[model samples]
Target: MEEESGLSDVLPRDLASLFSDTYTEESHYQFCGQQLRITQLYGARLGVAAPVWDAALNLCSFFEEQKLNFKGKKIIELGAGTGIVGILLSLLGGDVTLTDLPHTLPQIEKNVSANILAGCPPNVCALSWGFDQVNFPQDYDFVIGADIVYLKETYDLLLCTLQHLCGPSTTMFLSSKMRAEHGTVDFFQHVLPKHFNVDLQWRNVEDNINIYKVTQFQN
Candidate 1:
């Protein structure tokens, strides 16, 4: 995707549309203790018309702490809504693949390009996810998603997607406000241990979020 030309192209207007009323271009959120560029795009209008909420950004503090040399390692991000997290990984040097349902691909592409306004880096495009086949790189080093679990029916497909990408060395990181919804904790408990070694790092009840590290192998 091409880098979007202007800052006006990426800014958000409404508070409710942004998931949290607090994040703005001037907001300083310290994650992992680094002052990093962060964008919150949930419900931020994107696309040919307006954007939909299917993804969000990575806290660069936490992201920078992650030692992924994107130089050649294969990385695939599931449910990449705004595509921020995946793009950041790509920017850091990974051979990145961004995947989301077909409906969200366009905005994902748009934001990918928009974020690259600072610079256009090369990376793979969007793909529709499937459970039956592990179609991309078989030896994936990392797989990640943010705020993806909120439904029961999607549990089967989400697990299928994660399993297809895991190969004994893959690491998975999922972040979420873990907002009140159907089957929230059940989804985490059922799928977390079965697919990857789960680590509950921290929880910010005030922010309604949690941090987890699920890896393919203990390091």
Candidate 2:
């Protein structure tokens, strides 16, 4: 999720301002040997789901760097702001679902439509963490998220949603920028460990971004 001041009413004003660029109407990214032109609504009242974030870019780079094949895999991205990560994976041949709150779907849909180069275009849906998770299947091969764990209030809801979506064999890739104010480090180190096995897959030290590989904790 992109940083926003109003998201939970806890994000600091200055921190939100750092990621919210009002002048950037679109963002271009190159991944999977393809260029992606993503439409962004940065200044819109859409809160945190409008613009692209560094965590999303780093996650895409991590996938490409690891040569992870998404061919024919069933994947879903939670809090898919701007739909950049899912769009890139879809281009790599994954059947990707990009989901966020109802009000945020239009922007994600627009980005998905604008970047449908080949293979199946990613599906866009409204999924409010724990609330509508039942509407989605739990058989996904992969569950992915970018910068979605910032709000401490949403921890349980996010955990509930993750439990519903991840099967025993499913793997999750969550990329987050460590923000002391937002308690992002606590979410990865303490909260998620109780139910999921979390491993640090990659770290962009300069950017303070960490990509974690997660899976259900089997008894």
Most accurate candidate by lDDT: 2
Top candidate on TM-score is 2
True lDDT of residue 23, candidate 1: 32
Question: Model 2, poorest ten-residue lDDT window?
Answer: 2-11
Clashing pairs for model 1 are 4-113, 45-51, 46-51, 54-81, 55-81, 70-93, 70-94, 71-93
- The whole-model C-alpha lDDT of candidate 1 against the native structure comes to 0.56
Off by over 4 Å in 2: 2-24
TM for candidate 1 is 0.67
lDDT of 2 by residue, 68-92 (tens): 9899999999999899999999988
How would you encode candidate 1's per-residue C-alpha lDDT over 1-219 as one tens digit per residue? 111222133334443344333332312233333232434333323221122222233333356656535567677777666566676666666677777655556656765665555544435455544543356666878777776665555667677767677778777777754644456576676656876788866565665666677777555
How far residue 125's Cα lies from its native spot in candidate 2, in Å, is 0.5
The per-prediction tally of clashing pairs is 8, 1
